[model samples]
Target: MSRELFYNSQSAYEKIHLQNALIFELSKVTIPSIREIMVGQLNFINKELAQKVAAKVGVQVTELEFPNQSLPADSNYQDLQSEEREAHTKLSAALSMDNTIKNTIKGRKIGFIIANGVNALHVQDLKTKLEGEDAVVEIIGPSMAQVTTNDGSMVTPKHSLTSIASVAFDALYIAAGEDSVKELLMANNKPHVLNFINEAYKHCKAIYFGEGSEPLYMNSNISLKKHIDPAIVSWEDETPDNKFIDAIAQHRVWYLELERNTQD
Candidate 1:
C-alpha cells in the first residue's frame, strides 16, 4: 500500500510539469500576436486623428501605398532598385546650373504675378528680354477678369492665381505698381497669394520683386528682411535686369541664411 501511494504521487508531479511546459510554449506564440494586433490598432487610430486635424485646417490628407506592389506584373523588372538609384543619382548630378547668358531663361516658363495697375513698361521690357531668350512668359492674375495696367493698357491673364500653383513656373516676377500691391494685400483670402509666394521661396525658385513693392513683402507672412533666400533679385535703378538674369541662371540659391536663423 505504501509503495502504491508513492508511485501515484510521482505520476501526479509528472503530469503537472508537462502541463506547465505546454503552457509556456503556447504563450511564446500568442504573446507576439497580441502585441502585433495592438500595434496595428494604434497606427490606425493615429492616422484617423491626423486626418481629422487636416480636415479642420482645410487640407486633404493622403495615405501612402506600397509603390513596388502597385507596379503591373508584366512591366515589373528584376533589379529595379539599383536602376532607380542610378537614375536618381544621374538626375541629381544634372541639376546644377552655371552662371552664363547661354543659360538665360532658355526653355523655362516664367510667371509674372500681377494685379491691376501693373507697371506696363517694366512688364513689357522684362517680357521682351525673357522671350528674346526663348523663355515662355505667362501673365497670372488674381482673377480671370481683364486687368488694366497703370498705363491704361488692358492685360489679359492666361491663368488665375487660384487656379495655377507656383510649382508650375520655373521663376516668378512681381511687377511694380502700388495699386496692384494694395489690391493684393487687401484681397479677401490674401493668404492664398502669400502662400503662393511662400511656396516659391521654399522651393528655392528664382524670384524677382520690382522696386517700391516693399509693402507687399513687408506685410506678407514672409519676413524677407529677417531671413533672405538666395536667388532673390530686387530690381531698381541700381540693379540691372542682366544681374537678375544671371541670378536666375544659377537655378537654385542655397537656403543657408534661413536654415541658420532657425537653428539660432
Candidate 2:
C-alpha cells in the first residue's frame, strides 16, 4: 500500500515535470492557507527557480484567491493530485518572454518545407524577417539546392526532405504547396505526417504554419488544444490561428492543472 501510494503521489509531480507546472504537495486535509504557505516556502528552497519563473509567468498562485476553499473531506482528491502535478510541470518549463525576447538571436535555425512550383516570395520574405531577428533560415525540398517558385524564380533548397528531419529545426515553418499538401495526405504518407507532428510535439518545439498546413497536426496523439496555447508562456501569433507557438517553444505544457483544468 505504501509503495502504491508513493507512486500515486509521484504521478502528480511527474505530470508537472513532463508538462512543466509547479505546485507543492499537501496532505489531503491541508488547507488552502497551507498550500499558499508551501509556495512561499519553495521560495527559500529554490529561489532562483522561483524568481526566474515569477519574472515572466507570475509566481503568484492566481487560482487560490478564494477564501475558505479547501478540498472536501469526502473528496476523492484526484483533482488535488492533478492540480499539484500540473504546477510542477509549468514551473520547470517557464522561460520568460521578457528574457527570451532580450537574448541574441544568432544561430536560431528556422526550416521551411516546400516543393517545386512553390511561392518563392513567401519563403524569401519569411527568411528575410527571421534573419532580421538573427535567425538562420534554411529551405528543405525535393532535391538538393533548388525548387521552382510559383511566380517563376529559381530558388535553392538547402536540405533535402529525406535529410532534414523535423528535430533538426529550432522551429519549423511548413509551406507545402497544393501538390505537396495533397501528397502528404496520401495513405502511405499519413505516417509521415503523423510522425512529423509527433516528433515536434514530443520535443515541445515551435511550429509555424503557412496556409493548408492544418492536416499535419490533424492526427497527432495528445490533445492539440492542450499544447495549442501553453499556459506557461506568452506567444504572439503573427497569424490568427497559430498563437500556440510561444508555449510550444517553452516546451512541455506542464504536469500541473490550472483552474481551467478543474472546471466542473
Best by lDDT: 1
Tell me the tens digit of each residue's lDDT in model 1 across 90-207.
Answer: 1221222221234656888888988889899999999999888888999988888898999999999998888999999888887888888877777563676787788877666777
Q: Which stretches of candidate 2 lie over 4 Å from their true place?
A: 1-104, 142-145, 186-190, 220-227, 230-264
Runs in model 1 with CA error above 4 Å?
A: 1-102, 221-228, 254-262
TM-score of 1: 0.59
Candidate lDDT scores, in order, read 0.63, 0.51
TM-score of every model versus the real structure? 0.59, 0.49
Any idea what lDDT model 2 has? Answer: 0.51
Clashing pairs in 1: none
> What clash count does candidate 1 reach?
0
